[model samples]
Target: MTSTAPVPDPSPTATTPASAASRGARSLARLGVHVVGDGVDVVVLASQASAVDLVLLGEDGERRTGLLRARHGLWHAHVPDVSAGTRYGLRVHGEWNPAAGQLHNPDKLLLDPYARALTGEVSYVPEIFGHHVTDAAATHHGLEVRDDRDSAPFVPHGVVLPASDPVATAERLAARPRVPWSRTVIYEAHVRGFTLLHPDLPPELRGTYAGLAHPAVIEHLRRLGVTTIELLPIHAFATEHAIAARDLPNYWGYSTLSYFAPEPSYATRASRDAGAEAVVAEVRAMVDALHAAGIEVVLDVVYNHTCEGGLDGPLLSWRGLDNTGYYLHDGGTPARYADVTGTGNSLDFRRQRVVQLTLDSLRYWAGEIGVDGFRFDLAVTLGRKAGEFEPDHPFLVALASDPVLADVKLVAEPWDVGPSGWRTGEFAPPMHEWNDRYRDSVRRFWLADAKALAQGGHGTPHDLRDLATRLSGSADMFHRFDRGPTASINYVTAHDGFTLADLVTYDHKHNGANREDNRDGSDNNLSWNHGVEGRVESGSPGSELRPVRRRSIRNVLGTLLVSAGTPMLTAGDEFGRTQQGNNNAYCQDSPISWVDWERTGWQDDLLETARHLLELRHAHPVMRPTRFAYGRPRSNDPFIDLAWFGEDGAAVEGSAWHNPYRRVLQMRRAGGAAANPRSAEGVAAPVRRDLLVVVNGALNDVDVALAPSRTQGWELVWDSVWESPRERHESAVVDGAFPDAGTVVPVEPLSIRFYLSR
Candidate 1:
């Protein structure tokens, strides 16, 4: 039951027509359902509609209708008696032409573009389509035939929420945990998957917002040293019709339905049953809890397109309100959508209305919901204007200049499936991009290269130079744009690909369960299954493969944490989580997609190594440099920022960078100088400790000569080959008994080591 408050009536006053128009325009600025004064003002943007009706469904099961007054492309109606929790929807009456891109179906109840909450879930039935589906084959062949069936029964309605709702008026907002970009360690996680199988979380709270905020979850993240939590899309989304028809769900939740509302399914059943306001309140509490723990939250937002798929898609919010205005349509045939995001349609950022909607949604989430940042899914599509991506596009410029959003982090996936979509480093400053080059290089060095060596060295495509560039923040890709190393969000694996454990246990993807006949996932996984495939039980014939795979996991985790950029770890990667080689688990809602809390002895060691690696990263500033190294010492500086050395303890030069057989290199970083010459406040920065990193990707252990540097001695701090995280091995360094510059130091095969210089 919803509680209602009494609404005050408007006072009668005489006004000129000009004054009335001015007042209506001012009211138009506040779009969607808003509790104004004492009444509910419902606003809908239907520029081409001849008439609009506000349909209300009362709790008594009675339906009431009210006509809206149209002024300047906006239809608004203020119901003085209607209070908060009023259920309503819009019915725009206009020409229902399919060929000309005017999809105004009066019989179908349309959802508001700015609706804060939805009453129910969308049921995908034939009535939801604007065109009738007489023959399924004909409909699938792109035939357009108008259907007169009403869609109110299958579509969800919008609910009016009061301004003083609990979610809107929660305890005073907490200050954002403004973790610096250099120190930011992102943990990409699914709100449900992260807590679904947690043994410590209560069953009812598991897979819900409250579960993510539970003390157990917070303690784990804090111990792991992750400063930010990047959540998959939590916006109200509907399962893809095709996937749902196959009894599968879009578990990733990329198909958004409502941008402002939190996905109600992610909330506890009790909160969901209470009302939409309860769901919002629950999400608010979770954000508050995370903030209190000094952890920032970043949402993966999908604004490139919507749930309403291509030309034959359903009549959801944007498609029904203004099809051509909201989505990009083919120039030759306006009825067909220009599919850029591979989601059937691409949002037309060229339209100011669409841009305004995106801005409004972002502002609402950042200001009201208190998210610290956003990771734009298929972000290149957002920068597309005139069928090409522009760095200074109006939408991009507006976002960069927005006062409220300027301070928050902005990350982009940086590409789409459209033309010229592989934009790895083209995004402007203040907008960090996911570095695919870094991901591929790391995978090749640790997994694919090792596999090549095992296969008689026939496929060694890269060498140590490639790994060096990625380790130093891929300056070849990002430095040209004046962006520093911090602009790179480096990760070896993410939600869309293989987990850390799977990288060394599966050479190919096992996506047969996705109903695509095993042809759905990517073919180029860049993985290796060591000596055997899949899980190896204790005492099995290939039992030795397990230890090898564990070592590979440790090496990858060590490299990722020590790399010079902002590192992001997938939720379960720190604990050796695997999806049974199922790289694409986007449709599976079972254990195949959930994070298993169960662990083996080796898995515990991996987790401990990951924790220690993150702590090491935090302790040493050289590992997370803010600026790209130039390999030359400044005039006033006592040491160079960075230098690369080959196996002979000499600087790598000439053709050595391209030598495929040379897979061993050492990096010396002069951490005594500031990672960035200047601080955020334009002042001189403090000096840090110097350090050295050694990586050997060869199949056999080799003796590596220590490079000459301006340090008295070097002490071994960490080694990836160590079986246990608690093992003390400082005696291996023998401090102050310095070896000559050309003296050899034995390095384990396929291992990485870190040393602190004194």
Candidate 2:
């Protein structure tokens, strides 16, 4: 049970006024307190309390106090003088009962629900924890009844602010750097890691919000051609008890402390001194800067759980405001929480109030913070019911229907730690999901069978087709109704798995650096070490394996760029930054996870490959369609966007998919009529065109017969092995008139080729 030691006399500076409402509020805010309304019409509601006091700390550090004394069954108080920028907190008096979830003690301070700004971090000391502090006090109470040294100094203080419209902010941001879903290339990065090691960033600005907008960082992003920068969580967070004991902070910021407050550590000098407004201004400035450069900012949000732990956890904002109401209470005991996020307590979205709070928080961030979109962490759990997570959960529907959020990109991680956690491609339309299937398929098609190729067995054509579908946005995964193609957020590697460099360098997870008994990273890595692990091409330049690695990187990147859906590139992958094999570098905030801007010789080559691929994707309108054109009449474009052909120029069979020995895929892209309605008169439209993409995974060179083309002569666009501009394919024309002889295109082993029909 929570019992506070006798409260020490308030400092004369914080003495309360003797008004009746103030006295009454001071009497009733002790138990089950709920405060609502903007400044000047403050209404404090207390369910069980003897006394309550409303204390307001001004910007000048001076505090004013008003009492809220309990009366009848409900204790209510109204203060009309309160206004914005007014910092307020409550002190309540009531019976402390921990087992019954009524942890109330008049001696402790309470934070207001509608608080706009927060002052300090939640201290994990004994004063903050209910049982820990009270138990320690009980032993001292036995020794001396008058020794009232209760620790009130550790509690978090809330700051009040005048209400403002969040919608206006969103409207201003709507036109800023909004790339269509097709052209968008997302670069997922950590706010701190993005520039922590940058030499150009000032020592003071390094890793801060200001650092993100620094010229060097911006220039680097521009060079990479990323349309959107998806930052890892930057919300205020708290270190868990176990992590704190180990002296490690929550680096990822997933364990949220306050949704409204930006992580204080991310801010610069002005933000720390000027409070939450400074944070908003600085972050908005960053967004504005990115918008000028045609780049969107997508925040990785964590709303499924809070930093507050389970039963023994500290009574933070939600716990103190309404313990049993805000969290999912266990059926066996309403006092305890139903843990689902694996972060101790799960928010009860089933509660309408909790749902409202979540919706409000999203609006606040999107509208005020000026983010283009949000990537929900463990999104499935946010909509979880008794068994499975529903697609039509109230929260999901609200987000889909809410005008402010509906237009903004709503991507989901799409799974949790519960039953059926691997719910990929399940989210509704206008939403993109991380396609792990694409990651696995790309990895296996290149690296996994390379070892077998050395033994003279080429990988299967079925394997090639599987890779083909992923490259075309895995239509098999999504439904016809769910905005086909864009529904899949395709990636070969993401934050949780092996990085692009590691995916080629290591076959196993190396998480020894996590300091958690090597239990952190994943083991299902579909990587191959290419004869030697964690090193490039076995220390040989221009070796046989070098082509394989280069071709593999090119294929994955080219596939991602030309694919139907949006593509995401992990930060620093373009430069081939390797983690030495460590997949879970979440704990290691040093160079292990940070992007090394300096590129090696091989890295520069890879970067060039990526740049050329991106240019090619941008040049082709057929690659990035607004909708799946191949699907049906209702779809946008006419001709099937992509068509797969087997070795003899015939349709691939479904049963041939599992054969690993066949590894050559001929992919065709067909162009269609434009979306403009003015074409009714059959104006001279662009010629019907088709291009061929050939991938050969054999260890030795092979000959790919070019299919007879009807359009003008083909131009060589790309080849994996040769340096981009220097690589070109030209041959004698092969048409039906000259069917007696066919053109033979030399295909390099473990390489990909692109031919464009002019």
After superposing candidate 1 on the true structure, give the runs of residues whose Cα lies further than 4 Å from its correct spot. 1-22, 61-72, 134-143, 164-174, 674-687, 730-743
Number of clashes in model 1? 0
Candidate 2, residue 729: the lDDT equals 29
Tens-place lDDT per residue, model 2, 399-513, is: 8899778668889998888678778877776667888788777777776767556645544323566787776778888754556777788888877777787776677888877
Cα-based lDDT for every prediction: 0.82, 0.67
lDDT by residue (476-573, candidate 1, tens digit) is: 87886699998999999999989999999999899988988888888899999997888889998899888888889989999998888899999989
Off by more than 4 A, model 2: 1-54, 57-96, 105-115, 133-152, 161-171, 451-465, 536-547, 629-640, 675-683, 723-742
Model 1 steric clash pairs:
none
Residue 603 deviation, candidate 1, in Å?
Answer: 0.9
Worst 10 residues of 1 by lDDT: 1-10
After aligning candidate 1 to the native by TM-score, how far in Å is the CA of 756 from where it should be? 1.2
Clashes (candidate 2): 32
TM-scores for candidates 1 onward, in order: 0.93, 0.84
